[model samples]
Target chain A: DVKVTQSSRYLVKRTGEKVFLECVQDMDHENMFWYRQDPGLGLRLIYFSYDVKMKEKGDIPEGYSVSREKKERFSLILESASTNQTSMYLCASGQFKEQYFGPGTRLTVT
Target chain B: AQSVAQPEDQVNVAEGNPLTVKCTYSVSGNPYLFWYVQYPNRGLQFLLKYITGDNLVKGSYGFEAEFNKSQTSFHLKKPSALVSDSALYFCAVSPASGGSYIPTFGRGTSLIVHP
Candidate 1:
């Protein structure tokens, strides 16, 4: 079975603080993605990495960056977090057909 | 640009009754459609996907989806609904032949099963 694990299940941060959300997949998949889920927005892609050091901006990539220094790990970085950035962050890894997602991190910014 | 739409914001059904969640997609070429369910405070779980071959794709937890090419729809269905099946369902679509495989997700439809 494929396993995708996230660093934190829940996190709270102050406004303008830097935040990092980590995701690791054991399936050795080539593609990893970051997304934020809101009530009415479903899941909006923030960033994705196809290969090591190769990153692309998804639909909503503002105020967020991604790092893929290794194949198994993908990290989402908020350079300076704001209250509006609070969301349920999800990470997924997959090949071409389907994606396996992590448990997700609920982020709350105050 | 590829896009997915879930027409219903919520679907209510009695337990043990048949249930269906509507999903439609728009893409330039052939589409790879998918259905995923998210429990409260949890990440999305892959229910099923329609890539090729069979138009009807069965997946985990007795869930299935039919891929209608002519209608451009992939609606999730279950023979008999359960209370546990209550969750947020999302439909996604990606172009079959594309450099980027990032799928566009629908706004999602909340499923509530009443006893």
Candidate 2:
């Protein structure tokens, strides 16, 4: 089974603080994606990594960045957490078409 | 570019009755369609995929989807609905033959199973 694990299921941060969401996959998939889900808007991709150290910006990449130092781990960084950044973040990994997702992390910024 | 659409914002169905969630797509090449279900506050779960030959694809939790080539539609269907089956559903599509495999996802459709 392909297992994707997120560092946290829930998170809270103050405004202007930095936040990090971690995701690790056991299947060693070459592609990793980070997305923030909002009501009515669906899943909008924030970033995706095709390979180690290679990253591409998705549709909405305004205040977020990604790091892929290894094949199994991908991290999303919030430069300065804002209230608008509070949402459910999802991480997925896949080599081709079918991606495996982690539980997700609900982030709250106050 | 490939794109997916889930026209209905929400679907209402009674338990034990059949349910269908509509999905349409456009792709430059042969299409690879996928259906995913998302529980509240959780990431999406893979339900099924139509990669090639089979038009009717069965998936987890008794859910199935049919891929129609002429109409360019892939709709998720279930013979019986359970209250537990209520959730948000997303449809995605990617080009099957092209070099690009990145998928475009629909906004999503919320399914509500009435008791």
Candidate 3:
């Protein structure tokens, strides 16, 4: 079975603070993605990495950045957290057909 | 651009009754469709996918989906419903060829099963 693990299941941060969400996959998949899910909005992609050091902006990429220094790990960074950024973040890794997901991190910004 | 549509916002069914969740899609080329389920406060789980070969594809948890090319629909179905089957269901689509594998997801339909 493929395992995708997120660094934190829940997190709280104050406005204007920096936040990081980490994801690691044991399958060594070439593609990794970050998405924020909201009610009525579904899962909107924030960023994705096809290979180490290669990143692409998804539909919504404002105020977010990604790092893929290694094949197994992908990190999402918020330059400065805002209340609007509070939401459930999910990480996924896969090649093409099926993508395995982590439990997700619910971030709260106050 | 590729997109997916889950027409129903919610579907309610009683235990032992059959259920169906409608999904339609639009893509430039042939579509690779998928169904996913999400429990409360959990991430989405892959239920099934329709890549090719057959229109009827079965998946985990006694779920199956039918692909209709003319209608551009991939509706999820099950023989009977269980209380545990209640969850948010999402439909996604991607181009079968000539595009990145990144899928476009629907807003999702909430399934409520009553005993």
Candidate 4:
């Protein structure tokens, strides 16, 4: 079975703090994606990595960066967290058409 | 670019009754459409996909979707609704031939099953 695990299920950070959300997949899929899901907005892509060290900005990548140093792990970094950055972040990994998702991390910035 | 749309924000149905959640897409090439369901505070789970061959594809949890090329729609359906089926349903689309394999998701439709 394909397993995608996120580092944290819930996180709280103060404003102007740095935040990191980690995701790891056991399937070794070639693609990893980071998305923030909001009410009514659905899942908006923040960043995606096709291969190690290769990253592309999705629809909304502002204030966020991604790292893919290895095939199994993908990390999302917030330069400086703000209250507006609070969201439920999801990570997915897949190849071709099918993607598997992690449980998701709900980040709250105060 | 590929895009998907779920026309209705929410759909309400009674338990044991038939339910349908509408989804439409716009893509340049043949579309690889999918249906995913998200329970409260959980990630989305793949339900079904319409890649090729059969226009009607069955998936997990007794969910099925029909791919209508002419109408550019892939609506999700269930024979009998259940209270457990209440969740947020999202439709996604990806171009089969060219472009990236990353699928674009719709805003999603909230399904409510009343007893």
Candidate 5:
């Protein structure tokens, strides 16, 4: 079984604070993704990494950036958190077609 | 480009009754369709997929889905519903013929089963 684990289940941050959401996958999958899920917007991809230090911007990557310094870890970074960034963040790692996801981190920015 | 649509925001049914959660998709080429279920506070779980061969595919927990290429629809169905089946259902689509590996997911339909 592929296990994807997120660093935090819930996080509360203030405006202008830097936030980091970490994800680790045990399956050693090469592709990793970060998404923000909203009520009716479904899951919007924020960023994806194909290999360590390589990244691509997704549909919604304006307020976010990513780091993949290690094969098993992917991190999402918020340069300066804002209230609009409050949502459930999901991390996934897998090959094509099937993506194994972590439990997700519910972030609340004040 | 690829996209998935689950029109209904919510669907309600009684236990032991038949249930259907609708999904439709559009892609440049033939698609790879997928259905996933997400319980409250949990990550999405893969239910089934339409890779090829069978129009009707069965998945975990007695759930099944039918693919209609002409209609561009892949609707999930179950003969009998259970309270535990209630969850957020998502449909996804990815192009099959070398377009893109990443998939597009629907907004999700919340199913509520009455006991």
Candidate 6:
């Protein structure tokens, strides 16, 4: 079975603080993604990495950046967190047909 | 751009009854469709996917989805619903040919199974 693990299951940050969410996959998949899920917006892509040091902006990439220094790990960085940035963040890794997701990190900014 | 649409926001059904959650997709090339389920406060779980060959693909938890090329739809179905089956269902789509492999997800449908 494929396992995708996130660094944190829940987090709370104050406004204007920097935040990082990490994800690691054991399947050695080539593609990794970061998404923020909202009630009505579904899972909107924030950023994705196809290979090490290669990143692409998804539909909503503002105020967020990604790092893929290694194949097994992907990290999402928030430049400065705000209340609006609070959301359920999910990380996924896969090749083509199927993608496996992590448990997700619920971030709350106050 | 490729996208997926789940028409219903909520579907209510009695336990042991049949249930359907509608999903339609738009893509420039052939579509790779998928269904995912999310329990409360949990990440999404892959229910099934339609890649090629067969139009009807069966998945985990006694769920299945039919891929209709003409209608551009991939609706999810279950023979009999259970109280535990209630959750948020998402439909996703990606282009079979040229494009990013990342799948675009629908807004999601909440399934309610009443006893």
Angstrom error at residue B103, model 3: 0.3
lDDT of each: 0.94, 0.94, 0.95, 0.95, 0.94, 0.95
**TM-score per candidate, chains pooled:** 0.98, 0.97, 0.99, 0.99, 0.98, 0.98
User: Clashing residue pairs, candidate 4?
Assistant: none
**By summed lDDT, which 10 consecutive residues of candidate 1 chain B come out lowest?**
B94-103
Tens digits of per-residue lDDT, candidate 4, A1-110, equal 89999999999999999899999999979899999999999999999999999999999999999999999999999999999999999999988788889999999999
lDDT of 3 by residue, A7-57 (tens): 999999999999999999999899999999999999999999999999999
Error of 6 at B78 (Å): 0.4
iRMS, model 6 (angstroms): 0.8
Model 4 DockQ, alpha carbons vs. true complex: 0.87
Evaluate candidate 1 and give its CAPRI docking class based on DockQ.
Answer: high
Residues B61-109 of candidate 3 have per-residue lDDT tens digits of 9999999999999999999999999999999999989987899999999
Runs off by more than 4 Å, candidate 3: none
How would you encode candidate 1's per-residue C-alpha lDDT over B35-60 as one tens digit per residue? 99999999999989988899999999
Model 2 CA deviation exceeding 4 Å by range: none
Sorted into a CAPRI-style docking class, model 4 comes out as high
DockQ of each: 0.83, 0.81, 0.82, 0.87, 0.83, 0.83
> In model 4, which runs have C-alpha deviations exceeding 4 angstroms?
none
User: Residue B37: error of model 1 in Å?
Assistant: 0.7
Judge candidate 3 at residue A22 and give its lDDT. 99
Fnat by candidate, in order: 0.79, 0.73, 0.67, 0.76, 0.73, 0.73
Among the numbered candidates, top DockQ falls to 4
In model 1, state the lDDT of residue B18: 99
> Candidate 4, residues B33-54: lDDT per residue as tens digits?
9999999999989898988998
DockQ of 5: 0.83
* Number of colliding residue pairs in each model: 0, 0, 0, 0, 0, 0
